[model samples]
Target: MPINSSLASLSDMAFGTAFVIYLLAMILSVVFYVKAAGEKPEGAQKFIGMTQSLVWLGIIVHLVSVVTRGLATHRFPFGNLYEYIAMITLFAMVVAAIFMQRREFKPLWPWVLVPVLSLLFLGGKNLYADAAPVVPALQSAWLPIHVSVVASGASIGLISGVASLLYLLRRWQPEGKEKGFFGKLAKPLPGAKRLDLVAYRTAIITVPVFGLGIILGAIWAESAWGRPWNWDPKETFSLITWFLYAAYLHARATSGWQNTKAAWINIVALAAMTFNLFFINLVTSGLHSYAGLN
Candidate 1:
């Protein structure tokens, strides 16, 4: 079937609207974080309800945007980088929403929102593609399964990475005083121990999910390319990402590496993931370069 141009336009409009809402939520969350770090804890608490409502609203609109795009294209919505980012941000927002409701994790809301907003902006400005059928390479049944699982893992990895980064910042603070820019940022977030735990627990989930995604991708690759592992840029970076996360988990559970070392490892894995998304997909020519960005 041909693309439903009407629905496609609606989806774009909804996506823009959702982006605005999420941007507002991020701004408010930042305000809350700032106020909480200062002398006005009560003022910070006031923004909590409003920010929460905006997040829920954004998630609903984001879901509509994804669904309408799928309807318009008559296939999975992640046939291109633009749609893939949409789906990834949608899942990230849902996970961030759940975390924001937890007392210990609420203060980290803005950190998570920054990456999501950045990706949304990049998608809208640089990677926007027309509603069309999936490419021949991605027309198989595995597209939905493999892409969705990988996107889901990436979403969770965002949260996990932010937590680990904050853990380092918190640990670096002086014994009694928050002295620097990073210190102030970390001071508003949960304590170092809690942040470490959050990173570890989330990594516990991220490793397996990400590994499974790689396996599924390999299976799909075998069907489409007559080989399971062709060492494509995306595939190679994905393997590196998987190994880094696995190492982070192992370090987290070990005796001497549980805190700073594990946190560093998780942060490195996230960097690898981001590199794969942008540098590998957008810059390198490979089997997975059909990002619709050119």
Candidate 2:
């Protein structure tokens, strides 16, 4: 089916609106951080409420953009890097919305918004593509299943990564005393133990879904290319990242490697996944290269 140019334009406009709303949300969150400093939790309820509202509004708009793009193209929207980034960021925003509803997790919105905005800018400026049907190789029943699972897992992995980074910073700071810039920044975040737990839970969800996505990719490859594995660059990096996450889980459960060590591993896994998403997809030639910037 041909692309619906009208709906395509509407999706683009909605995406732009989502970006603006998210930017506003990030600003409000930062303002909340500043005003809430040295104030009781009860004193800062208004900022939290406003930020959370913007976040939810952004999520709704972002979902409309993704859904309308799919409707316009008559295929899953995440067939290329541009659409994939949008879908992944949408998931990230939804997760952030859920977390921000809790008082303890309210401070995390700005942290999450930075990366989401960065990715959206990257997608809009460098990776934007017109809504259209995917290539023949991507026209399969597994496309939506495989890509959606992978994107969702990746979004959760990002959350886990942010939590680990916050955990490390919080752990490094002296108790009840702010030393410098990093210390003051980490001060508003949840306690290190809570951050570590958040990291662990998010990682647990990421690894299995990510692994399942890989297996589904293999199945799709077998049906499409008449082979189960081709050692594509994306495939290799994805496997490596998966192994890193698995190691993170192992270390988390181990005696000596439970907290700080496992947190470091989780951050590394997130880095690896980010590398695969950009470097392997954009800088390297592979069977998946077609999905790169156009």
Candidate 3:
């Protein structure tokens, strides 16, 4: 069945509104983090807890908005650039929350959540478009499977990138009490060596799933477009991203590229993924033009 145009428009409005709410929550969280930095012994804990609560609330609303939009469209909510970004941001938040809770990586929350919030805002402002029904090319079972896995992998990449950034901030801290906001922020971040290990762990978890997603994408392309590799801009960039991360893994395992250097390579790999998802889809034209804003 086709979605009613009017209903789709309303859903978009709700999603956009929810996105704004999430952005506001992120701002509040950041403010609290700043305040906590200057607070006394007990006040800091309360501020952090409040900030975390706000973040959680924002995530809940965001999740509901995305799920409703998906149901209304009668397809996975990743058929277009807008939905793709929203889903990716959602996955990133989920991964961050889970990792923070499970691995006791609470100190990394400020760094990780800020980027997730930024992505949410970007998805709403830059990528927002009317949700439409899926095209014939995207009306395959593999569509959701492929996108979900890839998005999760991208979430891991996001976490790794943030960890790398934190690692850099911590590694360069100055001596004495003149560390400033960034210096204080760096205090709780894992050591440079630990940050490198965490980043590699994230990439290791993501790379194989990303590889599977690409392989499945190729199979789906063969079935739909009659070719497994079309040399599309998106495909090319994705392959490049895969290879970059692959190199990161190889260098770490064999070439002895560890610490800041490995973190830098992970940052580059994540950048390639971001460019493939955002710039290639928006600025360039190709088979993935289907991802462009309407």
For model 2 the TM-score comes to 0.96
What residue runs in model 3 are displaced by over 4 Å at the alpha carbon? 4-10, 17-21, 39-41, 102-104, 174-182
**Between candidates 2 and 3, which one is better according to TM-score?**
2
TM-scores for all predictions: 0.97, 0.96, 0.88
Report the C-alpha lDDT of model 1 over 1-294, residue by residue, as the tens digit: 989999999999999999999999889988989988775587787786788899899999999999999999989998999999999899888987886688767888788888899999999989999999987888989999999999999988988998899888888873247877766766677778888888888888888888999999999999888999999999999999999999999888888665798889999999999999999999999999889966
Error of 3 at 35 (Å): 4.2
Candidate number that wins on lDDT, 1 or 2: 1
Local accuracy of candidate 3 as per-residue lDDT tens digits, 137-228: 78899889888888888888888777777777767873233277677666555567777677778889878988888888898899989999
The predicted structure with the larger TM-score, 1 or 3, is 1
lDDT of 1 at 264: 94
Candidate 3 weakest lDDT stretch, 10 residues: 36-45
Which 10 consecutive residues of model 2 have the lowest summed lDDT? 35-44
